[model samples]
Each structure stands twice: as structure tokens, then as C-alpha cells.
Target: MRCLENRVPPPLLMVIIGLAMAPAITPQLPYAAPWQWLLCALLVLAGGVVVSLALRAFVQHKTTVNPLQPARATSLVSSGIFARSRNPMYLAMVCFLTAWAVLGGWQWQWLGPMLFAAYIQRFQIAPEERAMLQLFGRDYQEYTAAVPRWWRWRTK
Candidate 1:
């Protein structure tokens, strides 16, 4: 398990999980309604926006966006979409997977996003955080303290 950390690319993992969802391993749910298709489209669009923003931020900051080489990052991006979620790219992937599951209307398909999240949290994010802490030290610590790894809704 430890050997698997930062080993598999996230996009590859996502594709593998998506492929797994194609088979009817569990009971299938009812077909999606027209409204569900609309919702799926919205989710896919949102995911694209998030990932694009995250990549743009990295580019603007001149930081490495390569997930496998967190230690090589030259900047700590904590603005724009980064301020909202530390792992916006991963969040975007989740949104995409969620949209797929919803559009497919399979009971087990919903697990794709959950499994992706869990795997990313343990294998990818943890390692990246460790590298960020090592590289950015207190600045990274303060940023983490102020921002959630994922987005949170404000409770009024």
C-alpha cells in the first residue's frame, strides 16, 4: 500500500474506475430523467471550470502542476480557486465522476467518485501535503489552517 503512493497518475486511476463502472456488477438504477441530464451537464461544466482554474493558477504562479513531483513546485498557490479548495483538480475529477454516475443511473456507479476520493486522499494528497509542508513550512501550514482541502458551504 505504501508503495502505491504517488505511483499511479490520478487521471489514469479515474479512467480505470470509470471503465470499471461500465459493467453491471451491482443492481442497475432507473434511467436518468431529462432533468438529470441537465444536472449532469452542469456538473461536467463545473468540473471543467474548476480544473482549468486550478491549472491556470499554477501556471500564473510558475509552480509545477505535476502531481508526481510536488517537491519541485516553486510556488505555493493559495489564491483564486486555490483559496477555495486545496485540491481543486481532484475535486473536479470527483465532479466529473459524479456526473458520469448520475448520467449512467447505475447504483454501483456512484461508488466511482467515492472510491476515487478515498484513494486520492490517502495516496496522492497526503504525499503532496507532506512535500508542501517541507517546502513551504509555516506559509503552507497557515494556508491549510485557513482553507479546507475540499470546498465547504458557509453555514449562516
Candidate 2:
């Protein structure tokens, strides 16, 4: 969440909440799409949420409520979920975007996921990683060398 620090404007959070609620707002859409697509979206959403939350709880235990700034972290998380993906929460957001697109039967919503990934990579993630690498040194280097940027095909 270092990327989420003070950099996240108040209005942006509100906008994110609203954008994220896009699927829920369109109640008619949940009944849309083929069942297979809906099921796939559900599974993806559930898995992503579970994995990401577990990783955050287990590895990033320290709360960074104000994560936008470059500051020293209370802990250097390198085990559990951190060992897998450096940006699981961001990946989870992508999963949510994909799921919402499918669940809403808005194929155009697929753009949501792609756009989210690009935006996060450019704005939040890349910077946080550079900071992390600088803070954690060779430890972070080794982790990055081993972990996939967006997935864990090599792990499980």
C-alpha cells in the first residue's frame, strides 16, 4: 500500500469506490452473461481476493494507512505472500476489473482491467518497487529475481 499513501487524493478514493461499485450498481447485469463466464469471474474474484488478502495480512502486516510517501517501513516483508508477488493487491484489483467486466456482461469492461493494469504500473507500482528495491537492497533483488511480476505460474 506504499503506493496508496498520501498520493491518493480524497476524491480519488471516492471515485474508486464508485467505479468499483459499477457492477453492484447495475443490478440487472449480474443476471447477464453466460453462466460459465459468470462462474469464471466469480472464481477469479474470490481467488484473487482471498490470495491477495491473505498475502497482505501475512506479509504486509504493518499498516501503511499513509503509504504515498517514501518512508521507512516498520517491517521488511519477504516471506509468505510477499515471496510470491510484489504487487498482489494490484493484481487483485485487475482481477476485480476482469470479474466486473464479465459479471456485468460488458465486454467493453474488459478494457477496465487492461487500463487498470497500465495505470497502476505507470503510476503506483513502478515507483513503489523502485523504493522497495532501494530500501531492501539485495534481499529485494533476490525476491524480484524469483517472483513473477503479476502471477505465480512458477510457484503454484
Report the number of clashing residue pairs per model: 0, 3
Which candidate leads the pack in TM-score?
A: 1
The TM-score of candidate 1 is: 0.92
Q: State residue 43's C-alpha deviation in candidate 2, in Å.
A: 4.2
Alpha carbon lDDT at 104, candidate 1: 75
Over the full model, what C-alpha lDDT does candidate 2 score relative to the true structure?
A: 0.62
How high is each candidate's TM-score? 0.92, 0.71
Residues 1-156 of candidate 1 have per-residue lDDT tens digits of 879889999999988998788665323335567887798899999999999999999999998988987999999999888888999999999998888888776577788999999999999999999999999999999999988998955521
Q: Model 1 segments beyond 4 Å from truth?
A: 25-31, 154-156
The positional error of residue 21 in candidate 1, measured at the CA in angstroms, is: 0.8
Instruction: Judge candidate 1 against the unseen true structure and give its global Cα lDDT, from 0 to 1.
Output: 0.88
Q: Taking the tens digit of each residue's C-alpha lDDT, what string does model 2 give over 1-156?
A: 544434763225434743865865377474665884767578587657756574566445664523364345544565666566766666666665566566665556566677667766766667767777788789878888888777674564
The Cα error of candidate 2 at residue 130, in Å, is 1.4
Residue pairs in collision within model 1: none
Best by lDDT: 1
